[model samples]
Target: MEDSEKNIELKINQISQKLKEIRLSKGYTSYETFAFENELNRVQYWRIESGKNITLKTLLKVLEIHQISLEDFFRNL
Candidate 1:
């Protein structure tokens, strides 16, 4: 794979990991429960947590639940 591709994949993984950590910290041990409670599409939420098809809209929804902004979402990086 190209270096750029690897870099992108790495970033995706980082974002997924961060989101998972946040979910756990919020007292959700199950992604399904988190999704259901948050009114998110379960499969889409799973995709985001799995580092798959994460869309900006979905990320924004999660950030909203966390009471954070887009800047805060990226502030860790």
Candidate 2:
């Protein structure tokens, strides 16, 4: 893969990791439970947490659900 592709994959992984961290901090050990409680599609949320298909809009929605600003979300990343 190209360097750009590798970087993109790395970023996706980081985002997925961050999402998991947020969920855990929120007292959710299961992604399915988190998705169900948040009214999100479980399968879609799984794919997102797996870093398979994450869009900016979806990310924004998740961040909004957690009441986190884009700046704060990416700050540690």
Candidate 3:
């Protein structure tokens, strides 16, 4: 892959790991539980947390459910 593509993939992996960590730290035992509490399906939540090319709207919804602002999310990274 191109250097840029490789970098993007690295970022996605990092983000996915961080998302999982944060969710677990917040006492979410399972992805399904988190999804249900956030009003999303398990599959959809999995895709988002896995950095699977989800839409910005869905990303925003996920962050919103976690009570995290977009700015804070980026700032913390």
- Taking all chains together, each candidate's TM-score versus the true structure is 0.94, 0.96, 0.86
Tell me the tens digit of each residue's lDDT in model 1 across 10-74: 99999999999999999999999999998998998999999999888888889899887889778
Model 3: per-residue lDDT, tens digit, 1-77? 99999998888777777777778989998999999987897998898778887677887787787788888777766
Model 3 gets an lDDT of 0.82
Task: Kindly indicate the candidate among 1 and 3 with the higher TM-score.
Answer: 1
- Name the better of 2 and 3 by TM-score: 2
Residue 51 of model 1: what lDDT? Answer: 99
> Model 1: how far is 62 from its true place, Å?
0.9
User: What's the residue-level lDDT of 1 in candidate 1?
Assistant: 100
- Number of clashing residue pairs in every model? 0, 0, 0
Write the number of the candidate with greater lDDT, choosing between 2 and 3: 2
Residue runs of model 1 more than 4 Å from their true location after superposition: none
Ranked by lDDT, top first: 2, 1, 3
lDDT (Cα, tens digit) per residue for candidate 2, span 1-77 = 99999999999999999999999999999999989999999999999999989989999999999999999999979
lDDT of 1 at 8: 95
**Prediction RMSDs, each to the true structure:** 0.8, 0.7, 1.4
